[model samples]
Target chain A: MSRYLAAVVLLAGLAHPAVGAAQAAQNATLRRAQQAYDNLEYRQVLTLARAALRERLTGAERARAYELLGFTYGAMDSILKAVDAFKQVVLLDPERQLDPNRVSPKAYSAFDVALRQVLLVRQLRVDSVSFVGGQGAVPVRFTVTQPARVVARAIGSGATVVIDSGAWNGQVNLRWPARLPGGDPVPAGTYTLVVDARLGQNTFSASQPIRVSHGRVDTLPSVTSLPGYQFLPETEIPPQSWRPVGLAFLYTGGALVGTLGLESSSLGSSSKRELGLVGGAALVTGFVMMLRKPAARPAQANILYNHLLRDQIARRNQDIAKENVARRQQVQVTVAPVSPVTPK
Target chain B: MTRAALGPLLLALALRPAAGQLVAVGPQFVLADYREVASGLRYRGNGFGGALWARRNRFSVEAAVVRLSFDPVAGSAADSGFTATQVDAWVAYDVAAYASIEVGVLHRSVDPEFDAQSVGALRVGARSFYQIGPGATVVFRANYLAAPKFSGGGHAAVSLDLGLGLDVRLAGRLHGTATYAFNRMNRRTNPGGTGEIDAPIQETVARLGLALGF
Candidate 1:
């Protein structure tokens, strides 16, 4: 009888009937915070959840409450503050074992965890790009931990606006095609590109400066003593270009033989008069040279022409003697007679 | 693409001691029509050819070749090769980068219709050469012909076929060609005088053609 009475007294002492009231108060606070959070009233919800947690409330519900507060701050553009709240959630649960269906372990649990790594974008600086290049408007974009819309601008032009799918940072960037719709090329100068973004109510901005160099990609800058052209010696020559050399020599040799034979033949003038044969062995040779299978022989001819052009000029000068003589004769004979040789 | 492309152009630039070259679409195309062999009348014809030359931004050379068949109206199937043949070649100087006048070999049997014939390289872009170069071509060339074989050398006189030619490509690979020629042909007779002639009938030819480069 004594032991039973002692047991009943101990049970009464150990049991605190007011504990249920405390728990009910905590549950009601959480429900209110969640309601405020769903309404996007982040500040109020954060305040409520923080107060409830401070009042000795613990467990997954508290963890979720902290997470909702982080989201609220994040949506409010208080990024650092949001990050801090999420960090606390991680530490509290160590292994991050939170009931996903209820809320989230991390204060900022994103839809895509694969993209959880924080993005710290550095400014894009164009050391130097040629203004004469075919493409314009080089694209430079950045991704951050949250949704953002970036506006890039140059010093003279208004911002080149771009909208990125903020969550995953996926975007379609456009650069000026070889020709712009406006028919004008972007000017060359020290240009500045500025990016402004406002995504999920949070805003961010950055600016990058670049210089537009004036010159052709293949042209050489006149440095003190170097050749005035940049050359990446052609790594490959089409079989059509070099192949003409061999065939040209062969055909040219044959042409030389035919030309010599026809030139030396007794059929020179008489044959020319009777048969109108003025050295016409060029057909076969030309055909052969041309049919040079259309691959490389023409290349040989151009090469030959380029190299021998100087000699050809000299030859042309020599050949012009006949024209000069004809002109002089026409002038002296006709003009002198018509003018009566006035003061000779 | 498809070799179905009408004209193929080759541009050559910068030559080494061995030769280095660059090609632009020079209007040039070669087309051969083989007689169905059953026409009982075999008419084989080859025509349309061109070439463009460059040492890059500095100098250029252009040329073309043309051949047309005369109806074979005068003989049997055996005379198809000898019935009527005309060819021309030429070169031009880039007096200005956009235009050139070529003075080369001209076949008397082709191209002399004067204004009616498109011998100017500028004609290359008109689909005249069936589409040659894609962007730009400038050509200049001259012509010269050799001994012409008339009647397969069967007691037929081998005569001189002289010519002056011109071709130009106003754009990348398109080109127009023309030829003024003095051609002479001799009738043939078998070795035993089956049918022979001592000299050939001489005629002048003026021909015009087109070429395209791919």
Candidate 2:
């Protein structure tokens, strides 16, 4: 039963041979160390991995050497030494990760302990954003491996702007308004967002490149009229009636009565020929007019309503003009992440 | 009044370049009836005239001049006839949308000197006007003749005049006009301080014309 449990433990540790496949070593010693680790030769892995570490290697190969040493130590039941080796592995590549489901529990535990021991900022990200100046901010997120004093900054175009500074650990989120202390947006150009974490003698940083651009802020349009309101006609046609002919008859009758009453008795009755001629013409004109369409007259209520609507539209346009003027003086700011340059 | 004063006045009013001013000028055909003292002393005549009207703002002016030659009608007790020249003028101010108060003068002269009464009087009156249709109006007026002077020398206790008028715009800037007027004067004269005797005069005139509006 003891031998069977030993075989099961060896199979579990060798389950993730593909983990090192992507980092095929160019150096003969590191290649031998990786082969020995895959063969479950823990003693040979420890010797060969330590020897490969002594040789000058690429940064990736060096991290691979340390990872092999960590797994070899965990298979030999030396948890302290395994954790020490993983610490070196994470220091060489802060973003290095080991899957707990594919690796031995002991190796995964040591890797976790190594991550907790280091002071590093990992997975730094800057999300693309656009906003009117002073209205919004850019989103930034990262992870810190240990409790540390973390400072985030943007440096470019001969200027360095500090984004945030605090003592924090684990996952951290920040918002950068990308404005100056005077409430103005920064000049447009390519910039590097750098995050630094320091814990006593140990320190690590991560960086991302971002681009800032400027654009004209959209202005509001002036209104010509209000919604749901309209102007009405200022004149209306009156209804047709017999008032014209009636008035003509009344006036003619008045003239006739007055003439008859004012006649002098000595002169008897004056001739009616003059009255017959003119009064006949008046009566005819009046009768014709009564049959005609009435003329349009002023609509007082509609005129007043149209005047008020025009006033309201004028006021609205004035307000829009003022807002457009303000918008013309402001700027739109856009920020987006770009492919990073080589970090120093 | 001479034609010289009246002609220039009408010309100036027509030529004045004032906003909202209306001016109309026309020739008129006139029909008139005249009687003196007794019904038998009557004459009927036809004549010609000219009329001018101008309005600006709420004020208006109107003038008419006619010349008529008359002969006694059939069975009349008159041996001769007369020629008469009459002038009438008024200046009015609107008191309401359709009403106005006016002051004016009327003067008539006879060519035969004594064949008929030559009268002059100051007129004070009120008129009402209404628009019967598009570009059509009717007017009526009543006047109290005050301070009368007659060529034959008379004192008039009461005198009155009444008129009716019509204007229709027949076409662009062209108008048709018609007017009728009647006046009566009650005069008492003491010839050589003999006794008071009644001598009254009455006349009726009709005018029809076409006016050019500006």
| Number of the top lDDT candidate | 2
The CA lDDT at A296 in model 2 is: 85
TM-score each candidate.
0.20, 0.64
* Clash tally, candidates in order: 73, 0
Candidate 1 local Cα displacement, residue A176, angstroms: 5.2
lDDT for A57 in candidate 2 is 91
> Would you list the clashing residue pairs of candidate 2?
none
Q: TM-score of the second chain in each model?
A: 0.34, 0.90
lDDT of 1 by residue, B1-214 (tens): 6554422312321111122334433333332222211233333333444444343443344443445443332332535343222334434444553444444443333222321111111111100111112121211122222333322333323433333333434344444444333333333435466664343233333334454433
lDDT (C-alpha) at residue A120 in model 2: 74
Alpha-carbon deviation at B201 in model 1, angstroms: 44
Q: Which window of ten consecutive residues has the lowest lDDT sum in model 2 chain A? A: A14-23
Q: Candidate 2 on A1-344: residue-level lDDT in tens?
A: 99999877766554374355425779899888777777777788889888988999998888888888887788788999989998988877877777767788888899899889877787788898998898899999999988999999999894679999999999999999999877789899989999988889877889999999999999988777789998888999888899889988988888899899998887888898899888888898889989999888799999999999999999988888998898898889999999842333
**Native contacts present in each candidate (fraction):** 0.00, 0.86
TM-score, A chain, model 2: 0.67
Show model 2 residue runs off by greater than 4 Å. A1-178, A191-210, A217-235, A298-327, A334-344, B1-21, B38-40, B73-79, B195-197
